[model samples]
Target: MNGVIAGISYRSLLGRRRIWLLVVLPLVLIGLAVLLRAVGNGSEATTVTLMEKFALGTMLPLLGLIAGTGVIAPEIDDGTIVHLLAKPISRPVIARTKFLVAASMLALFAAVPTFVAAYLLVNLESDIAYGFALGAGVGGVAYAAVFMLLGILTRHAVTIGIAYALIWEGVVGNFVPGARRFSIQQWAQTVADQVSSSPFLSTEITIGFAATALLLVTVGAVLWAGRRLRSFSLTGDE
Candidate 1:
């Protein structure tokens, strides 16, 4: 990946106050972890539940949406994307570079906070932290790629992304057992379940299946986004 393209992507994401917007979710997660632990009101079950529900589930997806869409959508909206696309760099490289930047931001804002929250909540069970940290890391990358593709495909990326995350992943996963197979949260929980030896932690999807699905989705979305970028039409073709 070109460092210049990566740098541009990073600045475009972080230079705006929008990056700070992502901080709210992680900070809330951490604050809840601390408050629960400090108040002596949290049990292992509560810790795991909070981490799975709020930290891993909510924060990871939210950060991914912001970083993923933030990197590319504004550029496309403001017509700055043509400037980048007009350069000598391959579209795939540009897409990959932006993916890396969004993934990195997710790691910092989403995954790291997940680790810290787990530590505060379930410090005795180190594997819980490790599991969710790895889970969040992988899940964040997947979410970034997916949301980035959505940005390329639609003007209302954030709205659609949130609906998918909360409605499809959260609600449907709870009600429809079959839907769990396709939910990113389940795939993430599968990764978490593998790393965490806790019997209480369970995933509907097998680790192998979830890992494979994640790989296919992340790689496929970025490649497709690259293709879209290659033939991107600002006049109306998007």
Candidate 2:
């Protein structure tokens, strides 16, 4: 993708009021981490549980929803997509550019804070801080791709993404043992298990399976988004 499109995507991502929506969680997470540090509670078990529940379970998915759709949906809704579609660049490039911007923003907003929070809480084990950070980054990329595809496939991308992430993955997947097999949080947790020394951290799938699934889902979603964008209809709506 060209620099112009990438720049446009970046501005579209962080410039709007929607960017504020993305900011709240990271602020909360960092604030909570600070409070935990102030309280002198550095239990590794608590760190594992908190990171799993908040960073992976909640913030990552929500950030995914905002970042993924923020780059594309507003254009589609307001009819600006037509102009971009008429440009010389290929649809795949546009889609890839948007995905990269969204993924990068998600990493900045969610993943980096996760690592800093881990450090604040004195997580000095096997670089579990870095491990969870990497997992957060991976989840951001995967979720951004998937939700951007959903943005193209459905107008209610944010609603459906939230439902899948919060209700399905957060609630149902937690209660329904088999559902965890397909959850992104579970996959990320598997990656976290690799570089972390927290025994309490566990995942339903093996690291190999989780990594492969994460890769397939990310790549497949990006390809699907590009294909959809290639044939995206403007019609009289423009």
Candidate 3:
């Protein structure tokens, strides 16, 4: 299992295409931040809001979906995943390794940039920058796990992921209080709520509980996807 994981991780790291996507996506987000900072002579509050609502809110989730899908869908589409399945490695192990890879990619592409962008936009007074970045980082991990599982379980993973991230979570979660309670992004915001000193900026959800629940749900989703992948039957294109 370890050998299979190592092989997959190493291959993913060395792959030019994969590495390029990881590097490019985060850089783009950071670049956008820089561009906004350069152009605007706005107040600090304006900058922070822009970074939070735009960068953290939009870019992070989208990047997670892309990275998660990229990690597994290519292998399945090309039928190279059978090579990993044919080994002594259990399907669960392979699924886990793939999920880890996807999560790592999301962290690199979404989370780190989000933090850096926040820092660039806001002062070091409160932990506002840190909190928003932390929230984005956690959300990135959960999003990656869920979307990676979607990739393994269905060919329509990208479409479904986009709909959930954009429509269900992005739109509904923002408008509906109840939906926010169920949202990964909202849970992440709870983390920011604790770190940031501003009462108005604080999340409605409690930080500690949200963090625990987020971790459990993410792990559960990964495990469920692994079990599902084990019995997944790949039929030839009709």
Candidate 4:
């Protein structure tokens, strides 16, 4: 059931008209990173900051939101999901498959581009490239789960995600110290900070414990979304 649903969702994503827009976002981020390097910043410090702030902070969340919401929202919107539900396949299977496609897409869009961007901008001797990429990858996992559930639970998932990603994480996190702890961006930055040779380029969080918690939340959210999807009533009159 899971395999069939996943296959269908994968094909649906591939057939999307604006799917190429998702591909463009990461490429543009990486291009800007390379351009920043090409311009020859005064120091590597600027490059690292650019990689941390623009690549991880900005690009990852936006890409996650788009990939996450795009996966299921259209089906629900067009009423095609009812056709899938009419089958013997369980709703949980359907949800999980959709999430798998969403999460995989988010990871590819967010993490791989980040690694390429890092390599373009910096030459850290430590495993900074791999570490930040891993952190960003995990961050994408969490975002995909959360936003996918949001897509199921509300009609306003995109708005909520945008508000949370841009207003809460980006704006509030910058101005308020306490808000930083609540941010996906902060958690991801903590992971990146651990890998960078210049720890001063980023701030550290308890990566060992934080990564564990993030993974748990992500998995739990995905499971909860599947359960929610199972119970979702698609009939308009209901």
Candidate 5:
């Protein structure tokens, strides 16, 4: 929550070419929504499917990886983290600051766009749009925390993140019934189920389980990232 550190981290995150990925993904979601609406396929069922398969399933995790890693990974890779580490600031503070920046970026690029796209597809009269938006926002924060820790723990954070998002979340989580229980996407869908009255928004995970899992994952990842940052060397060795 250090303003100076958060500001620097925000600028650093937005400066990266990965920001374009952030921008483009949401645009694609919205564009698809527009196309669906134009084609008269913007039913509640369709909206739920699009939100579940594309917004929550795909775009959320990808943006989380970019923002989470972009906040600090580039600096660590280029040896510029030494400048931050040399300051009087504690390692946890730096981790917290960068995490805050990443979360805010997720809120903007992921959550807001999700709401807008859902609204375009199904309007705001029902809870579908709001439910999915809230779920996305919560899920984005959790993803940011997890991926930020990954960035601290490994230089190949992006590679690991892509594998997790695509292989684990997109493929396994979708098709494998047992594996869906462990997915961030499904947890978020449980949140959406609790909010939306739409039967199409149901998940095998209950709201209580989803909320608890999200809380534990986000807090645990941030704390672990802080612990890892404490031992990080100036040479970028952990």
Candidate 6:
């Protein structure tokens, strides 16, 4: 919400070496879509599989980790966050600003590319493209909030986030019915299912559950991060 904080956060996030990581995933996603299209494998099933498995499952989490952590982690790690904390600005505003930066990064790097790739693979014949795109955008925001809280909570945000994304989301959520209720990916997929009439794109999670969970997680993580920031000590203790 604070423009100055948002500007500094943007520069901090984009100026880092991990910016390449942000660029790579989207490129790989679009490239995969192109390859599948060329091979005539752009069936609804294939499109849904790719979008669900690769785009929402893999790329969204990784991009979220990068953007979410990159916004504030490095500053915290290097002890430069003290400079910002010393400002008269409210701690919540700082947290919210960095969150907005991370969310915007997801919108650009995760959501937009998802739409483009889905469109490339399936076009407008069905709502799959729009469905997946919106799902990804909303999911990316939730991921950003969660991972941002993780960044504030620990220095190993990326490591823990990777494990959560790959193991919990990719493996467990897919196979375990109960676990799917807690998964951001599954909730997002449910959103996609509601939007797209394609039978290939569906989830065990209902739309009501998905909407409620997404809203709760996103808001809860952001508010928690703000509270943590408010009490954060310059010595790196909360």
Q: After superposition, how far is residue 234 of candidate 2 from its true place, in Å?
A: 4.0
Instruction: Tell me the tens digit of each residue's lDDT in model 1 across 1-238.
Output: 7899888888888788776887888899999998998999667788779878887777888888999999898888788887777778888998898898888999999889898888887784848888998999999999999999898888899899999988987789767999999988889889999999877688778899999999999999999999889788545355
| lDDT by residue for model 2 (1-238), tens | 6688889888888788988989999989889888887898766777787789999999999999999998888888788888888888888889998999889998899899999888788666767788889899998899999999998888899899989998997998778888887888888888988878777777677889888989999999999999998777655141
Q: Please give, for residues 90-201, the per-residue lDDT of candidate 6 as tens digits.
A: 9988989989999999999998999999899889657999999999999999999999999999999889999999999899998998999999999999998999999787
Any runs in candidate 4 off by more than 4 Å, and if so which? 234-238
Off by over 4 Å in 1: 124-126, 233-238
Number of clashes in every candidate structure?
A: 0, 0, 0, 0, 0, 0
Tell me the spans in candidate 6 whose CA falls farther than 4 Å from its real position: none
Q: What's the TM-score of each model vs. the native?
A: 0.96, 0.96, 0.86, 0.90, 0.97, 0.98
lDDT of 5 by residue, 50-81 (tens): 99989999999999999999888888888999
User: Per-residue CA lDDT of candidate 4, range 1-238, in tens?
Assistant: 3777777777776678547867887888788877877888625566567666777678888878887888787778888777777778777777777778888887777888878776777754455667678778888888888888888778899899999988997899767887776778788878777776664466645877567768787888889888887775656211
Better TM-score candidate (2, 6): 6
Give me the runs in candidate 3 sitting further than 4 Å from their true place: 1-21, 39-44, 233-238
Flag the better candidate by TM-score, 3 or 6: 6
The local lDDT score (0 to 100) that residue 84 gets in candidate 6 is 88
Worst 10 residues of 3 by lDDT: 229-238
Candidate of highest lDDT: 6
* Candidate 2 vs 4: which has more lDDT: 2
Per-residue lDDT of 1-238 in model 3, one digit per residue for the tens?
A: 3666756654755474666756776677677667767877434566556555665667766777777777677778888766766667777787777777777767666767777876665655477777777787788888878878788778898889889878877799878988888888788778877777754475678877788878987898789878876775544231
In terms of TM-score, how similar is model 6 to the real structure? Answer: 0.98
